[model samples]
Target: MKRFLIFLYFISSALTALSSEKGIIDLADYHYNRKEYYYSITESMRYQYLYPRGELYSQSMLITGKSYYKGGDSGRALSVFSECYNRFTDSEAGERALFYSGLIRIDSESYNYAAKNFREYNYVYNNGIFLEESIINLSLVYALAENYDEAGKKIAGYREIFPEGKYIKQAEELSVLIKEAESRPEKSLLGAGLLSAVVPGSGYFYTENYMLGIFSFGTNAALIYGIYDGYKKKKQFQMIFFSVIEFSFYNYSLAGSIKSAHEYNENKDFKKELVLKFKSEF
Candidate 1:
């Protein structure tokens, strides 16, 4: 009975894999808890391979995604997380997949895609653990991406959905900062140059450099007064020399003011982006 023997061998292999399932899952979890992500990844892969139809199939896939993420393999982590939920829509692991997928997209600076993922999570898993966090972060990502209009909508959604959400205070503060950020261009080349030309230090003030603005005002005022004094003294040599100095100093101040404004805006935007990025990491 060659066919019967072959069937018996298949049955034995299935029984052996079934018995090993508990050990496989346990070892994976043990390694994961110890932060041995690479080792955890190996065990998870083995379990998935041997137990394709196991009860823990979705959990195994989730473990694999988490391990890849912990091991600093984000692209791989995203891939596995997507596969987990795509394969098991009804499992709790699918809820986790939604959150992690959005998180990884944020880390990768794919803000729009991250927003989409978070939205899906919010709609599908309304009672999920990370829902509040997802809503708050979704608004931040849009702001960070410079899509302020969409960010504003997200804030409205946050308030409507969570009038006194956990992150309410945080969201309010961020909104204030973002509103301030939106009030003016970081550096307006034409604006800076025009302001500098009209008022020696006003451009610097507009750029929020008070000290430099004061210095520019004081320096230009002194030089201008010196030229005037020399002219009134009827000293030809002194007048010419002081006039030239004043002219050059005033000209340089105008250019410097514009440059400073540009730099100030650039630095401010950079810092804002950094703050947004750091929030995503946590």
Candidate 2:
């Protein structure tokens, strides 16, 4: 009985030492597999700090970023993914990092940037496990960036690349949506400006410049009130005062809001034009 107890005590001590040495890797992996991303990230970070050159460092970085992304910290995830891409270029973890970085970029409204990363991932891991997903995103990135021409070309390319893609239905629907967007006539800011000239504040409404219109209306009201008070006081100087204010601030705001409405339209049109240009090139 004494010998058995001694043997068990030594075994427990050995296990404790082993766990102390590999707690980061083992605990992180265990947490990650169980979908406990927050805990996984914590454990993985500890492992990374203790053993920067550990074999699991690449995975640790990858999972750390994944945890941040899942926890709604896309900016931090992007930063960590970039680090993984730079530090573990030859590892399988690096491939996943690059791929996921593109996805996060798209979500963060950096479509152009995501498109570049997606292209790089596609080239580096040609026909790899993520090939289908990468190709689908290639089309989607262009579309989200408002690059209809690029989106269309990429869609066609995707069809050729993945004739039987898992997301064929989704890709087809996206292709149709892009075509419809291309058909719509781009709105004209110059037209909006002309419309405003005919009807003061019309351009403001067209351009959704509500605050500016309110300011214009308010200024006009103040000018009228000044003129009325001057007439009541029988003061010639007050009439001139009201006239100056009416011609200056009130008129200026009205004209400016109309002009701004036109400019806003032009800027939106320019964005659409850029989208078409990107499509043709891509």
Candidate 3:
């Protein structure tokens, strides 16, 4: 009875191993055919563990990466594709790995990094799958980073390389906007003071700086009121003295008002320049 039990146990263990192997292969085929890529990836990975040196090893990795990509896991997809590219450089699957890697980076908003990877792939494979996309994304990154000069250079490069690209018209329009902004005059707060110096209240008015103008006018009014009030009190000597002082200071306020305008204009120039620079790059 003990010998019979041992034989039955051996048979059961052998069948279990065979069934597991069959299950892995069947699940892989079923999931792949049904376009359930996420499941296909799991089954394929299991198959790899069971048969590390199987003929399907490289193909399985490619499928797993593709599944991750389609399942909206771009970061993981990129990692897997990078591994495939490094581990199986001679395989046909490896040829496309870098191309997909660039796409994943671009999708993930690592625009500058994507551009570098794409450029490398293009250099090696001349006719890389996503060359135009790489160029467009590189241009966008420089623009977003406020590097207008470099961004402009990149746009020029794109025009030369892909004049008929799908987004050529949009790129051209953006270039024109940058040029227009670059041509505008710059403003500064100090310039407002200078404007006020040249013409009382002029600087504030020029910069649409009405509050400062009102404040300047109010100070003059207060001095004038003080002079008149002193005179109305019937203090003859005091009234004359206050009147002269008020008159002189009123003139001084006029001069200061003009200086304030100049400062306002200077400020305007600076702000205008800042806005122009930002728009040009972005």
Candidate 4:
């Protein structure tokens, strides 16, 4: 009777421990669903502490990393995700971790690193759940970096691999945009700088900033008149002051024109639109 009671007690204790572990994970998941990222992280970490080798260990790590990410602690999130990926490389959680790491890199504007992560995920998990997402995002990363050729190739590959993929429409749209962006004429920074040097606001005009060009030209013209008047009156202090002001304005116009030219060449409007679309879609 004593031995039987002891055996029963051990079974009950095991069941209770298992139940506690499950309860912690469930609570963490509930918090995560509610977007209570801090509490989710707390519960997930508690699970990890109480059940280091628990069957739900991978899930707990994933939740902890995701919570950190949703809470805007991207650095910590990346670290946790990388750790989870390393620990459970063949698991679903590891695949998601790798994919999310790439997304975090994209948010940071680290396009090269994002591309690497996405590529790695694609290569490592050919049939992974995030395969389609990784492929599209990889192409987008290249597009963002202005690597049109590579971007096009990736999009084509995505189409070939997933003929009826959910992202086909997006891929096609991005492809058209890429072609248009490539065909657009890029402004010359050197040309803009030279124009401004020769004609106070001509650079701004070349960069299509007519209002700024007009303001720059008017200001310089007025300053030139001031200097001329000062010289004619033989006023040394007035000439020096006008000369300083004109010099400063001329430099400002020149720099502004160059910056405008660079921005025009970069096609910032297209990039801004693309980024917004990418964020909304993905």
Compare the candidates by lDDT and give the number of the best one: 4
Clashing pairs in 4: none
Query: Candidate 3 lDDT, tens digit per residue, 1-282?
Result: 999999999999976764475566566657767779778888878878987887667666777787787777877888888888888766666757776676566456575776677567657666555556555555554554445687688779879988898758766865775565456454455665565555445555655658866765566567667767877887777777777876675556555555654554344344344334322110
Candidate 4: tens digits of C-alpha lDDT, residues 1-282:
999999999999976754598888988989999999999999899889888899999889889988888888989989998999999999988998899899888878799999999999988999999888888888888988999999999999999999999989999999999999899888899999999999999999999989999999999999999999999999999999999999999999999999999988877688777766663221
What's model 4's TM-score? Answer: 0.84
* Model 2 quality (TM-score): 0.66
Error at 11, model 2, angstroms: 13
After superposition, the stretches of candidate 3 with alpha carbons farther than 4 Å from their true spots are: 1-37, 50-59, 90-92, 165-282
Please identify model 1 stretches exceeding 4 Å from their true place.
1-19, 188-282
Counting clashing residue pairs in each candidate, in order, gives: 0, 2, 41, 0
lDDT of 2 at 116: 92
Model 1 error, position 177 (Å): 2.2
Q: Judged by lDDT relative to the true structure, which candidate is superior, 2 or 3?
A: 2
**Model 2 per-residue lDDT tens digits across residues 1-282:** 999999999999876754563656777768877878889888888878877788778888887888888778999989999999988777788888999898887667688888999899888888666777777777877776667788888778878877887767777877877786677554455655565455545556666677876666666777878898898898889989887877786556556865675566345554454344322110
- Identify the runs in model 4 with alpha carbons over 4 angstroms from their true place: 1-19, 232-234, 279-282
Lowest lDDT block of 10, candidate 4: 273-282
Find the candidate with the highest TM-score and give its number: 4
TM-score of each: 0.63, 0.66, 0.45, 0.84
For model 3, what is the alpha-carbon lDDT of residue 278?
A: 26
